[model samples]
Target: MIINKILNVDDYYYDVFMAISESLTGFSVNELQSTGLAETYYQHILNQIEMATFIDFLNVSKNVLDNAENKDQLKNAISSQIMDNPATQQIAQSVITLWYLGTWEGAYVNDRSYKEGLVWNVMHAHPPGAKQPGFKSWETKPVNSNS
Candidate 1:
C-alpha cells in the first residue's frame, strides 16, 4: 500500500522557498532576507495555495536548482519547468510579483512589504511616502544612476 505524505510548514520548506525565491527574483539570498519579509512572504504563499500545490511547486523548484549546472541552464530549467508548466506558472509569477511589487493577487501584503519592495531597489528609489530618501534628496542624481 502507498501512503500519501503530508507536508507542513517548517525550516526545510522555508529554505526551499527562499532558494526558489532567490532564483525567481534574481536577488541574492542576503538581499532578499534583508527585507525582513521572507518568512512573511512564505506564509503568505501558503495561505494563498493548498499545501499539496505548494509542495509540488517547491519540489520542481528544488529539482531545477539541484540539477542545473550553470546560470544559463538554471534560467532555462526555470523557464521550462516552473514558468511554462501550467501547474506552477501562476504561483511562480505570484512569487516574483510579491518580491518586486509587494502585492499578491493585486493587493499589497503590508506596509513593510511596500517599504521593502525590490522594485524600489531596482529603480534606485524609495517607495513614495513609504520612505523619504532625505530632505531635498530629489535635487541630486541617484547615487548609482548611469546618467
Candidate 2:
C-alpha cells in the first residue's frame, strides 16, 4: 500500500482495475490478487513504459475513474480512452487477456512464459507437449482409424 501511496495511486487506481477486470472477466478481485495476476500485470505495464511514466499513467487513470458518476460512466470513460490511445490500450487489454487466458502476449516480459501462464490453472489441464495430461488420458476416448 505504501508503494501505491508513494505513486499517488493509493485509492482508486487498483480499485478501478479490479472493477473493470471483474466486470469484464467475471473473476473476483481476491482470485486475481491471490493468483498474483495484479502483480504480473503491473510488472508487464512497467516493462512497456518507464516507472515514472507508468506511475503517472496510473494516477491519471485513477483520476478519470474517480470523476465518473456511475458504473456505466466509468466503463465508458475507460473504454473510450483505451480505444483512443493505442499504446495504453494495448497495456490495458494485455492485463484483461492475461487474467482470462493466462498468457502474456507482450514482446518483452520474458519472466512470464507459457509454462508460468494461468491457463494451466484455469483449464486444469497440462501444458501441451510440455507434460502429459496423465496416465492414458490421451487415449481416454476411442481412437480414429482413418489415418
Candidate 3:
C-alpha cells in the first residue's frame, strides 16, 4: 500500500525500492499515496545515515543486497538515493557539478564512442555545469594499438 503511494508520488521513478521504503519507514498506505516519493525516500535515507557510516553506505550498497537482513535495510537505501527535494536535491546535484560527464547521455567523447544517458533519466537532472561526463561517463580514450 505505502509502496503503491510512493510509486504514485515518485511518478514511478523508483523501482522496487519503494517496497523497502514502505517496510522500513512504516509509511501508511494512505501516507505513502499522499506524499511525494522524494519526500518519503529522502526521509528514509536520512534514517539509514544515522544507522550506517560512509564506508557502510558504500560497502552495504554494493554488498547488502546479497544479505537477507541487510537486504531489508538496503531497500530503504536505494529509495533514499532517489530523493529530489530542494535541500537534499542539492546533495544529488553536487555530484553532477563535480562530474558532469557522469550525467551526460548525449555527450560523447572524441567523435564516436559509448552512448551517454540523460541526466534525469535515472535520478534528477544534475545541476548545470561544464559538459562533463554523461550519466555513468561513457567517454573513454581511444584504444591504443601500439603497446
Candidate 4:
C-alpha cells in the first residue's frame, strides 16, 4: 500500500508510534530507540497498510497510553484496545514481530534489523553469523548462565 503521507521525525504520530511500541513490546523507550530501527519500522508499517487504518491504529494506541495510569492498567488496555480489536490486531502483531524477529509478514526488514532483533537479546544470544561473540567465545560459559 502506498502511504499518502510520510511522517517526519518530529511528527506527532511518530511519537505516538514509539510510545505505543514501548507499551506493546514490554520495552522501555530507551531500549526501543537503542535499536535505531523504530522509525524504520514505523515507516514500514505505513508502507504496508492504508494510511487510514494506520491512523486508526495509532489513535487507539494513543488513547490507551493516555488513559492507563499503571503498568497493569496499560497492559489490560493494550490487550483490550489493540491486541483484541480486529482493526488493530494484525498491525499490533506485526509491530511485535518486527521488534522481536525483525521481520514483518515473514520478510526480514533489513540486515541491520535482523542483527538487531530483540529476540536475540531476550534469548541472551546473537543472530547466527552476525554479531559474533568473538573467537571461540562459546567455549566459555555465558555471563549470566545460572550454571
Please report the candidate that would top lDDT against the real structure. 1
Name the lDDT of candidate 1.
0.87
Lowest summed lDDT over 10 consecutive residues: which window, candidate 1? 1-10
TM-score of each: 0.88, 0.53, 0.21, 0.89
Off by over 4 Å in 4: 1-8
| Alpha-carbon lDDT of model 4 | 0.85
Model 2 global lDDT (CA atoms, 0 to 1): 0.58
In candidate 2, what are the lDDT values of residues 41-79, reduced to their tens digit?
Answer: 655656666766655656656655567787787677777
**Candidate 4: tens digits of C-alpha lDDT, residues 30-124:** 79889989888888888988999999999888888888888899899999989899989999999899999999989999889999999988888
Q: Lowest lDDT 10-mer window, candidate 4?
A: 1-10
10-129 in candidate 3: lDDT tens per residue?
533242333433433444334443433334333433443443342333332333333435545555544554233343334333323212232222333222112122222234333345
Model 3 misses residue 84 by how many Å?
A: 27
The TM-score, computed over Cα atoms with residue i paired to residue i, of candidate 1 is: 0.88
lDDT by residue (1-147, candidate 1, tens digit) is 111221343567787788888889999777998998888898888898899999999888888888988889989999999999999999999999999999999998988999999999999888898898999887998778799
- Ranked by lDDT, the better of candidates 2 and 4 is 4
Q: What's the distance in Å from true for residue 8, model 3?
A: 7.4
Q: Is candidate 2 or candidate 4 better by TM-score?
A: 4
Global CA lDDT computed for model 3 = 0.36
Ranking by TM-score: 4, 1, 2, 3
